[model samples]
Target: MGKPVACLAVAIMILFLYYVIDVISHASGNRYKEGDPIPLYANKVAPFHNPSETYPYFDLPFCSPAHVEEKKEALGVVLNGDLLVVAPLKLDFLVDREPESICRKRLTKEEVARFRKAVLKDYFFTMYYDELPIWGFLGKFDAEGIDDSIVTSVYLFKHIHFEILYNKDRIIDVIIQGDLQNALLDVTDNKEVEVDFSYSVKWIQTDIPYEKRLEKYSQSSSLLHNMEAHWFSIINSCVTVLLLTGFLATILMRVLKNDFVNFTHDEEAVDEQEVSGWKNIHGDVFRYPRCKSLLAAAIGTGTQLFTLSIFIFMLALVGVFYQYNRGSLITALVLIYAFTSGIAGYSSASFYHMLEGKNWARNLIFTGSLFSAPLFLTFFFLNTVALAYNSTAALPSGTVVVIFLIWTLLTTPVLVLGGIAGKNSRPEFQAPCRTTNHPRQIPQLPWYRTTLPQMAMAGFFPFSAIYVELYYIFASVWDHKIYNIYSILFIVFIILLIVTAFITVALTYFQLAAEDHEWWWRSFLCGGSTGLFIYGYCWYYYGATSDMSGFLQTTFFFGYMACICYGLFLMLGAVGFRAALIFVRHIYRSIKCE
Candidate 1:
C-alpha cells in the first residue's frame, strides 16, 4: 500500500511539472534587432469553404528550399491542423525589400491542372513569422461583362506583398496580400507557361504595444457586425431564466404549502378524506433506479464535465488561454480532462455505494470509460479518415502514445485512489419516508403529463436559451473565426445550467404530484433531452449558415458535435437529478406523517 501510494504521488508530480515546463517554454517575449534573420514558415493550404480538409503547403507546386525543414510546434497547434515548414523566401527584421523573384518554374500539364483546380475551389494559404500569422488566397475565378455578354477569366496570383507592423524590437502584426492586379497569370489553358514567383516586404512602425497586438484579430469586422445580435440573444436568455425562476418559486412556496396544510389536518378529518398525490408514494419515491451502475457512472462523468467547463471558462476569461495562442485552449482541455478523471471516480463510487451496489470494481471501471470510450472510438474513426486524405489533422504516433501513457499512468491511478476513498467514506442512503415491502401501483395520466412530452417541454427551453450562442461557437470551430468573448460565453453557460435545473425540478414535482413514483430516470432524461435539440441545431447550422461542404469536414463536424452533445447531456442530466432529489427530500421531510 505504501509503495503504491508513493508511486501515485511521483506520477502526479511528474505530470504537473511537464505541463508547467510546457507553459514556460511558450512565454511570449521574443525580441529581435535590426537585420536579424526573420524565418518565415508556410503552413497548410485548404479550400476556403472546407477548412478542415487541409494539405501541406508544399503539396502544391510551390517553390521550396533546397533542404526542407519543419518547424516544431505545441501539441495543440498540430491538433488544430497546422503544418508549418520553413519557406524558401529570405527576410530580415526592419529591412525593406524591393520586388524580387524567388524562382522560375515551367508548369507541366499536371501542375497547371492542380493550380486551376485549387483556384476553382478558392484555396487559401497560411504563413507565419515570429509567431504571427498571415493568410492569402491562391487564385480566383471571375466572370463579368456588359449586358448579355459574359467573359470568364481564371487567374492565379504570382506575387505576394507583405506588410509587417512592429514596435521597436517587437513584432506587432503581419499581413500578406496577393498582388492580383499586377501579377495575375492566366490559367485558362493547358499550354506550358513560365511562372515567376516574386514578393516584396515593407516594415512599418506602429505604436500598438506587444500586449495588445492580438486585439486586431479578435475584433474582426465580422465579429463587430454580429456583436449587437450576440448581446440581444444573451438578454433574451436572461429574461427566460427570470421567468422560469419565478414560476418555480411560486410552485415551491404556494402550491406545496397548500398540499402540506391539507396533509397535516386532524386525524379524524384525514381518515374521512382520501390521501392521494406525492404523499401517497412516500414509501417508493427513493426506490433504487434501474441500471444503477450506469446512472452512477453518468452522474460522475457529468460532474467532471461540468467542473471542466467552469475551469476552462474561468481560465479563458482571465486570458490564460489568449487569442494569440493558437492551440492553448485545446491543450488545456486535454490536460484538465485527464486530471479531472479522479472527480468522476469519486462521484461515481459514492453514488453507487449509496444505491446499494455490490460490484464496486465494475462500477469504478464503467465510470472511467463512460465518456472516454465513445470519444476514443469517434476519434479513431476520424483519424483514419484524416490519414486517408493525407490531412494534417491526423494525430501522430508519438502524440497518441503520449496521450495513452498519460491516461494509463496518471489518470487511471488517480481515479482508483478516488474510488477507494469514496467507497470507504460513502454516506448511507437516507430517505424521508420508509419503504414498504412491495411497490405501489401507478395511476394513468394524460399525454401532456407523460414522460416524453415532459422531456420535450423541459428540453426546448434550455435549448432555446443557447441556440443563438451555438451559432457563434460553430462559426469559430468550423470557420476560421476566432472567438474571444469568454465573459459573455460564461454568462450564457450559467444561464443554461440554471434553466435546466429549474425546469427539471418543476417537471419532477408535477410527475410526483400526479402519483408517479419513477422520477429517477425521467428527471435525468428530461434534462438530457436538451442535447437532442442541440444536435439538431448543429444540422441546421451546417446546411444553412456555414460554407463547409466536403466528406472530411462533414464527418469531423458531426462526429465531434455528437461527442460534445453527449457530454452536455450527461452534465445537464446529473444537474436535473440532483435538483429533483433535493426537492423530494425537502418536501417529504416536511410532511406531517404518523
Candidate 2:
C-alpha cells in the first residue's frame, strides 16, 4: 500500500509540473500563417480613478459589425473585470491596411452627452489581439502647446493607428497610438453630430524573441526612479535587519546568560530558588494561552498563507506569471491556496492538541474557515456593489459555483487527511519548567512596556521596513500598473521575516524579564500589530495620494485591504509566537529547575 501510494504521488507531481510548464509556454496566442485572420477582443472601459468599475465597450454609441460575437474567457479574466467580446474590425496576419472607416455613426443629443462625459472623466479603452494588449485614451485635453493657461478646444480621437510587432509568425507586441491631432472631432452641443471611426494597421518584424517580448511592457517612463527607490528601500531594510540582529546577538544573549547564571546560583543555594523577574513565573510561562482554539486556527491558517506566498513569489520570479494574461496570476493564486489547505489543517490540529483542546471537529472547521470566511463576505459585498453599478467585476453565478466546487472537492479532503495525521502524531506539550498550583502575580511595569505600547513599537519597525515597497504594490493593484520586479519583492519578503522574528524574540525577552507570564498571545499580537499599521497606511494613501473617489472605489479599496491586512496579521503573528516560544524554552531550560 505504501509503495503504491508513494509511486502515485511521484507520478502526480511529475504530471503537474508538465502541465504547468505547458500552460506557461502557450499562455500567449498560438502561431498563425501569413494572411490568416486574427481575432480582436474589446474589453471594458473605465474612468481613471476607479479602474475596477468597468463597463462594456459597446456602452457608448459605437457602431458594430453585422455579426458581433461574445468571447468566452477564463475565470481569472472575468474576476479581473475583463469582459472580452469579439471586435467589429477584421485583421489579417502580416497584412498592412490603408486608413479605412470601420463604422460611422451620427450621434443624437444623449449619445453626444455620454461621449463628452466619458472624455472629460479621462476614460481609456483596452483591446486585445493575439493575446497582446493595446491601450489608448478616448480623448486628449485641450492646451496650447505645453501651456496649460491657454485653453483651446476639447476633442475626441476618431482615428486609431495599430502597430503590431512580430517575430516570425507570433505576435510580439501590439501598440495603439491615437491620432489625436490629425483625426479628431470637436465636442459640441450640436443636435446633429457625425463621427467616423477609422483605423490603420502596420506590421513590423523584430529580432526580439517571443519570450523577451514582455520586457517592453514591464518598463515604464519612471523606470529609473522606481529602480532607485526599490534599491534604496532594500538597502534600508537590510540595515534595519543587521541592527536588530546585532542587538539580539550582543545585548540580548549577554543578558540571558547572566540571568541563567544567577538562576542556577540561587537554585544551588536555596534548593528552591526565590522567584524574581522571569524566573519567578517560569511555572506559568508555558501555561496554555487563553482562546487556544482561535490561536491554533490562526497559526494554522497563517502557516498556509506563508507557504502560499513563498511559492507564488518563487513562481513569479521564474517568469511564470508575466505571460500577458492577468487571469493566469489570479488562477495560480486560487489553485495554490486550495492545494495548501492541508498545511493549515495539520498545523492547527497539532497545536490544538498540544494545548489540551477538545472538540476536534470544531477546531478543524475553524481552521478551515478562519481565512476564507471573511474573504468570502468581503467579495460578496463588493460583488453587490459591482452589480448595482453594472461593472464587469461582478461575478457570474456559474463562476461562483465553480469556485465553490473547487473548495469543496480539492480543499476539504486534503484538510481532513492532514487533520487525521496531525491528531495521531501529536506529541505531549513540552515545557522547561513545571507549573505551580497557583498563578504568580505580575507586577506593574513602565508605561512603555505595557501591551499596547509594545504592540505599537513592535509594529512600527516592520511596517517601516516595507512601507516604501507598499506604494509600488498599491499602484500595481489599484492603478493598472504592471509590477514585474519579483526579485526585489522576494528580497524584501525575506527581510520582513528576519525583522519580524528578531524583534518578536527581543520583545518577548523583555516581557519575561518584567515577570510577565502571559507572553503567549502578547507575542503574537506584537508581530501581528504590523498589519494594523499597514491598514492605517492604506487609509493614509487613499486620502492623501490616491485620486480614487466615489462609493464603488472607496468600498472596494477598503474591503480588499481589510482582507489583506487580516492575512498579514495572522502570518506575522504566528512568526512572532513561534520565535518567542523557542526563546522562552531555551532561557528556562538553561537554568536548574525541580
Candidate 3:
C-alpha cells in the first residue's frame, strides 16, 4: 500500500480494535452498576479499627451527647499525608439480595443476568487477569433460558440481587444479580407491588467463599476459561521476569559501564572545530540508525501504557466507574491513552530525526501503537474467547466493531495529526551561540561521561510524584481493593508524560555539565533510569509486605516485574526522544550561531 493508504490501514486496524471495545460497552446499555463485592481499600480500613463498632469513627454526627460519648470509639486520628490513587471499577453481579437493599425503579431479568455475568466476568476474571481471564462469566457461563422472560421484548431475568460494599459516605464494591427464569418462575412475586431499585439498605460482606471454579459442579464441560487464562498466565509470567530483569540489569549495567569506561567518544576538540551541532557531544541523544530508536520507541510506548493503566486504576479508586460500572470508564481512559501515543513516538523520533535521523517509519510505527497493541490484542482475544465459550458478560459484537472504528477514525488519525504538528514545532537550538570557531580542548570527567545516570536520576522527582498513586493502583488491581478514581489519575498521567521528559532534559543538561560530551546514549539512559527506580521500589514494596502466598500472588508479583521491565524500556525511549530533541536544538542553534 502507498504511504497514505498504509497509514489508513494502520488507522483502520487500531480503530477497529478500539471501536470494538467501546461498542461492546455502550451497546450493553451500561447495565453494570456502581460498586461491587470487592474489599475496601487500606485507606478506608485505617479508619475502621474500632473493635466494638463496625462503623468508621468519622461518621459521628456530633449532634447530641450520645454521639459525643461515642466519639472515643472512633477508628482513627486524622492527619495529612500523600493522597493515594486507586483503580477504576467495573460492576459486581454477584450475590443474592439482602433485606433493605436499594429498590430498583425498573429491575429486569436480562439486566440481572448480564450484570451477574458481568460481575463474574469483570471483577473475578478481570481482577485476576490484566489481559483477560478464562473463567469470567463471559468466558464460561451462558444462561439459555433468559429469552422466555421478556415482557416488552426486553428480556429481564427472574431473580435479581444488587450487592454492594461500602465505607460510610463512600461505597466501595457493588453486585447486582437478577434471576430471570426464577423471576418468571414464580408468578407470585411478580404479580405484586412494583418495587423500585431505591430500596434503602446497607449491605455487608459475608464469609461465603467464592467458588474456585466459575461454573458450579454437576455437568462436566470444557474449561475454556481455565485454558485461556493459563495461556495468558504463561505469557504474563515471562513478561514479568524479563521486565524485572530488564530494568534491574540495565541499571546495574549502566552503573558498571560508567565505572569502567566512557561510552561517549573522546574526539579531541580541534581549533576552529566546525562540527555538526551534536558532533561535539557523542551520545545516544544524537541519532540511532534504525532498530535502536525503534526499539526505544517500542519500550517507551509500553511504559506509557503501564503509566496510563495506573492512571485508570487511580480513577477507579475515587469511584468514577466503581466495579460494575467500570467498562465505560476503562474504555474512555484507554482511548485517551492511545491518542497520546503520538507524543511518545513523535517526541522521540522528532528529536532523533532532527539529529539527522535515518528511518522515520520504524520510529512512528513502534511509538504510535506497539505498546497498546499487545495488551489490546490480549483483551480482544480474551473477549473473543469469552464469546466463543458463550460467557454471559462477553463484549457484544457491535461494540467491538465500534471500538475498532474509533481507533481508526479517531485515535490513530488524531495522534498522527498531533505528531505532525509536534514535528513541525521545532525546538530553538542555541548551540551556535556557545560553539567556538577556534578549537578548544575537550574536558574528560569519568563520572560525567554517560548521560544514562544523569537522565535516569532526572526521572526521580517525577517518579516520586507518581509512586504513591501507583502503589495504590497496583494494590487495587491485584489485591481486589474497591477502586473508583479516574479524573485524578488522568491528570496524573498527563503530568507523568511531561514530567518524564522534563526530568530527562534536566538530567541530560546536568550530565553535559559534568563534561560528558556524549548525548546519544546518555540521553536515553538518563530518562530510562526511572524504570529501574520504579521496578526496584515495586520489589521493595513487595518485600515489605506481610502477606505473600499462593500461585496467583506469586504470579502477580512476577507479572508486575514484566510490566516494570517493559515500562522502563518505554520510558527510556521517551526520555531519549526528549533528550534528543533538546540536543538537536542545541546543534541546530549552534550551526545557526544562535
Residues 1-594, model 2: lDDT tens digits: 123223434543553475469566775547999999998998878898787768888887776767668788887777787888888777789999988897888888888778777887788888888877877888866766564755466678888888899999898888887854678877745456988999899999999887777677777534435687678767977787788678777998898778777777746465444657887777889888888998889888888888778877867776667736568778777877777777777788889999889877888899999989999999999999988998888888899999889989987876776676667666678888998888888888899999999999899888888888888889888877777788888888887887788889899988988888999889999988999999999999899988898888899999999999999999999988888888888888888666
lDDT score for residue 48 of model 3: 12
Q: Per-residue lDDT for 138-202 in model 1, tens only? A: 98777676662443777889999888999999898998878557788888777778999999999
**Which stretch of 10 consecutive residues in model 1 shows the poorest summed lDDT?**
1-10
Q: Candidate 3, residues 1-594: lDDT per residue as tens digits?
A: 124334533654564455446544533332223444432111111111111111221221111122222111111111111111121222233333343322234435443443333322222211221111112111123233577332222222323333454333233344444432324222112232232322122366444322212122211222222445534543454444346435654664475345223323343443335443233443333323345655546544644555456544544454344333324454545465655555454454554455455566566666666655655665565455444543322345555676678777776775565445435555433233344343334465566344444644566755665665565566554443433345545655555555566555545455544444445455555556667777767676666742454333344355545555555656555545555555556533433222
Candidate 1 residue pairs in clash (backbone atoms < 3 Å): none
Measured by TM-score, how close is model 1 to the native structure? Answer: 0.94
Q: Which portions of model 3 miss their true places by more than 4 Å?
A: 1-319, 322-324, 338-358, 373-456, 459-466, 483-506, 546-553, 564-594
Off by over 4 Å in 1: 1-28, 144-151
Clashes of each: 0, 0, 103
- TM-score of every model? 0.94, 0.93, 0.43
**What's the alpha carbon RMSD for model 1?**
3.1
